[model samples]
Target: MTLTLHLDAAGWREHLQSVRNDVPGLVPVAKGNGYGFGLARLAAETSALGVDTLAVGTSLEVDQVRAGGWDGDIVVLTPWSRHDPVATALLGDPQVITTVSRVDDLTTILELNPQARLLAELLTSMKRHGLGRADLPALRSLAPVARFEGWTIHLPMRSPDPLAEARELATAAQAAVEAPVWLSHLPLDDYATLRSELNVEARLRMGTALWLGAPKTRRTTARVLDLHPVRRGERVGYWQRRASRDGWVVVVSGGTANGVALSAPTSAASLKQRAVALATGALDASGHALSPYTIAGRKRSFVEPPHMQSSLVFLPGAAGVAIGDEVPVELRLTTATVDQVVDE
Candidate 1:
């Protein structure tokens, strides 16, 4: 039994190259399941793209990139801290650029490795992590001691006018210290406009859009391990919930361990979406949750919660499925951990 991601190799490569060409100074981000293609695969793809730098979410991922044959620079997106031994250990590596969000962290980093290459992350409206505007003055004083690579700002995805905010922040960062600006979550057109308007070097850190933007280029599927005919009201699965209709207990290869039925907190922005989410939660509470698996051209419902390595989905009546059939699965690639990726 297997859960696999099927990739159109030629189409995927073409898409990657197209994105790379469209976005000037594109830094492919390979972190956190590598956007479902895996870190090593993305690292290898980055090498194939011939990009000078690859950005990871944390310092711990540096070794994975290196092991995947990425000989160029690796930039850790997470802010550097003295408490993180992995981040501290990477300070001396010239090829690794650590993001310094706080002024005091910069000083400590400099004391540890004066020649450490650093990226200054300016605080954006996201307010997640970064050096505040007030901290910029202090940053200027200590920036020269370290190899200051550039400035980075992670813009929020849901904003009225992110370009305007990015322009303002980029301007502020330049005012403090004139350096290249690295950004995230900005559209390609907006990034181009910003680069032209600012007249400064800029790079875009891309993850989802770069890898999984073209959904047609990839497909995820799970192999059907077994199927058992069950009548209505027959108890089955771990919870032993009675079947709602005459159907088959279809066990497929994918579960929580493989990121099936697992979801990150939803950032539902609209009233309708929130209402729909509440409805879904209510259904789940009553044991009528929808499964991601698609059988006979329709999404099925889970008979019960998924097991460690398999899921039992209810297939009502005869739906033309078999023991070794591969059914399509819809899931977030970033959160999925498939057994194999077959590049056709």
Candidate 2:
């Protein structure tokens, strides 16, 4: 079965504009499989949209925008390191911008190549990596070798009030050198609120909110492949989905290949607090369909466990639905890989 992802470009552009209204400056984040858009296409789109800048996950991503002839500034979000020769080269050129996370890393960058435009990464609670508030002055002290492009702060995801944390970080950013620019990965609502409160101009680094902002922006669909009626107590699939009652075993064309079964726990508490994990110590790579899909514009449920290449849906009364029928997978397409992009 072919995986199909549909994008309503007009819808997305409008969403981007709505998000832009919250923050005066926008830095669209085009990284990590390009949020399933592919980096180059996103770069082109963001460039055309007149964003202040575009941030990528790595130095390698710089080639993506440059190859497309995008003349806008490309910011590398990964923490600075000396080993990143290509990144260093791109920074040496004025075409790229970087985030300085550590005093030593920033020093190495300055020593390796002077005249690098840089944004001082103010450490946040996420604790992934960044220069702590205490270290900011020392790094900023190295003004002889580097020019402070702006200030940056990364907000934690799923926080109750990302705006509050952003405000706190914005307070710390005031200590940084001139030209403060904020980059937030938090929820758009939070970023928008804190952005308005910030004393300095803000650039919200948006990924999911821009590409997968809402269901209205995109749709994913998979076709039904096969179907069979099974009697009670009949076995089906590796899980031996025994029929609790008379129903048809419907085979759908979607599986691990489509990232159907691939999902990490929602949070630590969701996994740790539960006693019986969903598939812990399971006999095979099998599980119920986690992704919701619509059939005939009606919601459908997973009949049994999903197979390796396909999934079996328990279609009790929907036997009237047949093969070649198009079903929309109710999934966040940004998190799912798009096998094909069908417009309209």
Candidate 3:
């Protein structure tokens, strides 16, 4: 059976409004598993925002968005030199703005299809694709051959400072090209300030903040796969950490496949907070109580590490709980893989 994921349509709409209010001209990011809402739904939702452009991850995803009848400028974030079929996506002029990172790719795009829109990518995080600012002059010099739309920078998710980086990018972009500048994958809070600081016409390709900005708008949950009673002296599981007291051992139908570890930490912490994860991992090593269970709609501590396609959890005396019950799970939609959406 497929795992069930619930989404708050109203909640998502509310979050969308909040983002738009904060950043007047917001470009919502909708790519990859639709951030758990699926592409069709996000395309439909974002189309309602009246935006001229929406960012897709790649060419394959272009069809996913196009199939839904989203008639807008599609900016594919990945570089155009992404293999054959992908590279060919850059050859078409059907409203796709392909990224050109290298000086060679610039000539390749124009030679293949001079009609296509080419937005030069400056080197940023992920270290893949894009020309360096120092090398930007060569590409800018080729603007006459290609239909240069603007400049773009892919900032780091783990960087300590993004605005400063944005400023540097703007300065470098000023030297390279005069077209509108764009950015990909930056924090939502940083956008308005950065856009203000730059004080020019700029665009940001947003994914999480636009789709998963408000936590209450989306949530994920899985079915209780199995349950068993445990005794105080009962020896159980891989690590054998023995039960401190009698309780119920439970299991849920969710693991890595469902984007379990796709997390976005609070604030701008580059690294994840290890306090809870380490404690949970330690419990799994101890091999005593299970970890993935819920009572009265609350997550339970795990007894052991999450196994393939499932996780074990321990429930310590919650009222009227049982097997096969759909427990409430607190998943960060901005960070979790969404399996399904329940329109509300």
Which scores greater on TM-score, model 1 or model 2? 1
TM-scores, all models, native as reference: 0.98, 0.83, 0.83
For every candidate, C-alpha RMSD to the true structure in Å: 1.0, 3.9, 3.7
Q: All candidates' lDDT scores?
A: 0.91, 0.72, 0.72
- Would you list the clashing residue pairs of candidate 2? 303-313, 303-314
lDDT of 2 by residue, 1-344 (tens): 76677888788778877766665677888887777667778878787777667888899888887676577888889877778777777777786888888888778877777888888887778888777778757854785457777778887776577677767767766655556666777665666676666666777777877777766777777788988988888887675767767877777777766667566654545655453453442412354333466664565556665555677777665476788776877654556566677766
Which residues of candidate 3, in runs, are more than 4 Å off?
Answer: 1-3, 125-128, 185-200, 232-245, 261-281, 288-293, 296-298, 307-309, 317-320, 332-335
Candidate 1 clashes between residue pairs 3 or more apart in a chain or in different chains: none
**What tens digits encode model 3's per-residue C-alpha lDDT throughout 189-229?**
67677777664688877787677667765555678777788
Instruction: Rate residue 162 of model 1 by lDDT.
Output: 90
Error of 3 at 304 (Å): 3.8
Cα lDDT of model 1 by residue, 180-262, tens digit: 89999998889999999876799999999999988899999999999999999999999889999998999999999999989
Best TM-score goes to which candidate?
1
